[model samples]
Structures are given as structure tokens and as C-alpha cells.
Target: MPSTDSSEAPNEASTDASTAPWDVHRLPRADGKTFLVTGGNAGIGYFVAEQLAATGATVVLGSRDADKADAAAASIRSRVPDARVRQIRLDLADLASLKASAEALRTDRLDAVVHNAGVKFDQPPRRETGDGHEAMFGINHLGHFALTHWLAPLLAAAPEGRVVTTGSFAATSERLDLDDLESSQDYRPDRTYGRSKLAQMLFGFELDRRLRAAGNTVRSVVTHPGGALDSLTPPRPPLHAPTTGERLRGLPAGILVQGKEAAAWSAVRAVLDPSVSGGQLWAPRIFGLRGTPRLRPVRGHLADAEVAARLWSASRDLTGVEPEFGLG
Candidate 1:
């Protein structure tokens, strides 16, 4: 495991999922603030909830499959006796699902929204969601975009709230497909996934800029797991049993960051560390492109201010949901 000494967590303290960084010994409030994590059944998302629930926060799993969600909640409660886990069915590929899930939230004060769910198809195929957006692009980027839009009110109501999105090293290589938002021209397995990740990073930075410009106090933060180091990477192994394929490629990420521990750090820091500013990209420190969660700068042509703005505008047009929260 990476040394906890280097974390920029509150008070420069070590960070564990269950305990706040030295800065925040108390897990955030469980009283009224609510948290929702996408793809919370297994891997990092599950661990995020585990830590949050263990510390006394209410969490809802945004899952596409109800059964998997139920299992996730039961599993968490088994581990953390005071877990407040709820399930909401959401399909990132479906716009209606995004809207429905957003409306399903009964709590008004949404302390945080984590977009951790993602997919990387191993084969090359021209796929689009029912909404006509590219499969990888739609689900990975647009789906979360829409969900964030719907939940803006929940975020705005909080005295101090945040929105965290997960991106990857693949994003540094991805160029904005402004001419073709849906990746219609050509499709390669890994590159297409990279394109989606790139879009995700752009969205995070752009969201922060928009929020700042609109005068909303809500903090917008973006974090990424090292390339192929994240828990939700391809060739997903069984619940407890990891396979040979993942082990070989992810040796660095695994060695640097074990299981959910690796993916959770940057995200946990982004939320708990108040010194962190908006539009900053956080990854691991050493060989971060492959392991641990550390704050690192990623420079790319696609992340150009002009391109980010263009992508944000296009996302609004595509989702038919204007950027209302931070665009005051």
C-alpha cells in the first residue's frame, strides 16, 4: 500500500476509508446529508459506501440491476451494522433511467454524488444507446452528465456540497470528438474507451468552471485512478477471486494500490481536503499512471479551455438538459 504519510488530507493525517484524514477524524455527518454512488455493487464504489456507512453516513447504490443492489446493501450491512443502504435502479445508457433515478431521491440535501460506474468493452463494435449516443460515450459521459443535472438542486441546497467524477489516464490521450460526439467515424476497442474517459475529465473541469462562474458554492472536483489501475477495469474478476489476466497487467496498480484501496484515495482526498482547488486532476504519486491515488497534473489538447467549453455546451444540447446548476 502507498504510504499514508503523503496524503494532503485534512491536517496532513493518514487517510483510511473508515477514518477521516487527520483533518477530519469524524466521518461526514449521517444526520441529514445523503450520498449516492453509481456502480456500488463491487470494487471501489462498494468500498466507498462501506467506509461511508461504517462512519455513519446514508448511502444509496445507483445500480442498473436491482438484485445486485440488494446484494450490495445486504453485504454492507453485514459488515457495518449501522449501514443505511438503499437501492435505485439506473441505466446510464437510458435517458429516462437517469431522469427517473434523479427524481427518485427523497432527500433534499445531497452532500455528495460520486460517478464511479463505467464500462470498457473488450471488442470493437459500433454501439449506441437507445438515445442514439455512442455506447461508451453515452453511458460513461452523458449518463452521468444528465444525472448530475437532475441532482443539481440537491447539491445546491447543501451548505457545503461537492460533486466528484472519476476519470483515467486514458483521458490524456482522448481528443474531443466535437465533429462527432457519438464516435461515428471509426471505432477501436481501447481508444474508444479512452475517448470516453477524456470526455469525463473535461466534464469535471468544465463543471467546476461553470459552477464558479454561476456563483454556486458547491465544490466540483475531479479524480482519476491510474490507467487500468481502477477496480472497474476490464476482465473483471469474481467477487473475491481475482484472475490471472488482471493480475498480470495490473501488477503495478495492484502492488501500488490494493483492491478498492487504490481507487478510493484520490476521491476521498478530493472530498475531505478543503485546500484542494477546483479543476485540479488528482492521481497517484509514483507510477500513478499505474498505481495509488495521488494529485498529479495531466496536460492535454482536449482539455484546452476552449474545448472544455465546447464539450459542455454540446453535452447540454445532447442531453436536452441545460447546465442549470452552476450556470447562474
Candidate 2:
């Protein structure tokens, strides 16, 4: 766990999640705001959607499966009777699908877009996308890269637009090389996933720099769900139907891990907290693995400006999505 000492934490404290002791339930009213959450059908993403909807935000769940998305949205409505929520089919593994999804959202003003969809690991031989790129790299980083580009116009048009990409603790421990982003030479599931997440962190920071330089109103922020588990999460059919093995696994993690809802505090804060700014990274307050959300310092490769710029260029080339800044 990372230390929460003021000296160690990054960025100064602004506003708490709510007026009452950093509680997520008391989030500011989001009436009339619209947020799109990728992978909202499951895990931390689903809880993110639920939390936003509870606060009067119009939540759009981006799921690869329409049925699963519908189920998640229905679950949200069931919990929050007045919750305005819907689902859109978005397969992160497919670039074509991502583009189309972005187009579908063109007419909507997106207050925030949470890039939360991701694959934890790839099995032996590794899966590839339609573009023949590694699954984790393509879906986690490249796919979101293109989607954000397509939606840049909509984001910029909003009063306070935000792009919150999900990051991971793996970034601090694992190695990465922007030169070989797809991991053609070195292919391991854990390392590949870590590199992809590092890329995401880089993209978030680089994006902020570009947006600032271009004088754009949109903000780019990054967040990580620290040690969250399904067994600890509220039951949402299709997404959080914990198995026997999963329950067994959760017993120990339940002690060491935070619930998905708790983990989502970082993302929710990133999107809705007026005090939070672009380029900041949010994570658990206690060692970055558990407790309330807080502004955390970014270190190592994730903080390298030159490397981040290079990664940004590589992303643009790989995804073929031109940067949209200061444009109508």
C-alpha cells in the first residue's frame, strides 16, 4: 500500500467526495449531466454507472453485449427508481465497433467518458484484434484512443468535459516499452496488461498537455480501482454473479481488498469533483489499494513528459486517430 501522508500524496486537497467525511453517496447533484462508461456492464464500471445515476446523471453504459448492458441498466433503475440510464453496444476489441459507437454518441453532449473496459490477461498464444494487434494493447489503449478522438468534438462542446481512463497498480511494478507497444517481441499476459495500463496513464497526462496547449475546455484524468473484488460487490446479474471459487477467493481479498463500489470512488471523484483538474491521477487513499479516494502522485515512467509525448505520437499513428484539439 502507498502512504497517504501529505508529503507523499500528489496534488493538493480540494473538495471531498461529499460534504460528509469523503462519502461517495453524498456526491454533488449531477442533474442534466451525461456520462458514458465503457464496460459499464460489469465490475468497477457497473458500480461507476450506478453511482453516477444515483446522483441524477444520465448514465450511458457501453457494453459489448447489448443484453448484458440492458441488464445492468435495468439493475440501476431498480436501485435508483428515478435513475436515467441506457445501454450502447460497444466492443472494445473491435475498432470498427468503437468508431461506430463514437459516431452514435456524436449528437449527445458527453460531460464525461470513462474508459473502464479492459481485459485483465490473455491466455497462452494471446488473442488479437481484427487489426491483428494484441488484445490488451488494442482494446485497452488503442481502441480507447480512437474512441476519444471521435468523441473529442462532443466532449469539447460540453461545459465541463472530462475523459477518465482506467489505470492499474501494475504500472508501477511492471516494465514497458513504447517502442514495442504491441509486445510482439516480449509477450506475457501480466506484462502486456501492465504496459497497456502504463500507456493509458501516459496518454492521460499527454492528453492534458495537448488540451491545455490547444486551449481546449475538455480535461483528461486517470484513475485506478485498487484491489477490488466481485464477491465484495453488490450483485448485478450477468456481471457480478460470483461463483463458488470466486467466493472462496474473495474471503481473503475481502479482508485486504476494497469493494467495487468503494474502488469506484476514485473514478467518480475524477469525473464529478470540481476541484480535481486534468492530468491528475486518483487512487485509494491508503497505499493506493484501499480506503477513500485521494489525489496521488504519479512517478516513474508514468511521469516522464518526453516519454508521454512519444507514446502519444505512437498512439495517434497506431490508432490512426488524429488529435482533436481546438476544433469545432
CA RMSD for every model?
A: 4.9, 2.5
lDDT of each: 0.73, 0.83
Task: Write candidate 2's Cα lDDT for 197-288 as tens digits.
Answer: 88888888888988888788899999998888767776666557777777777777766677898888899989988888898888987778
Model 2: lDDT to the true structure: 0.83
Best by TM-score: 2
Q: After superposition, how far is residue 222 of candidate 1 from its true place, in Å?
A: 0.5
Candidate 1 residue lDDT tens string, 1-328: 1234543444233434554433223444455557888888776777666666765678889998888888788878887787888978888999877777987878877888888888888896788889998899899999998889888888888876788888876776567668887778877768889888888888888888888887788887788765433432433223334566655766655554444544566676666555556677776665554444455544556358898888888988899885478475
TM-score of each: 0.84, 0.92
Worst 10 residues of 2 by lDDT: 10-19
lDDT of 2 at 27: 89
Q: How many angstroms is residue 253 displaced in model 2 relative to the true structure, after the best TM-score fit?
A: 2.5
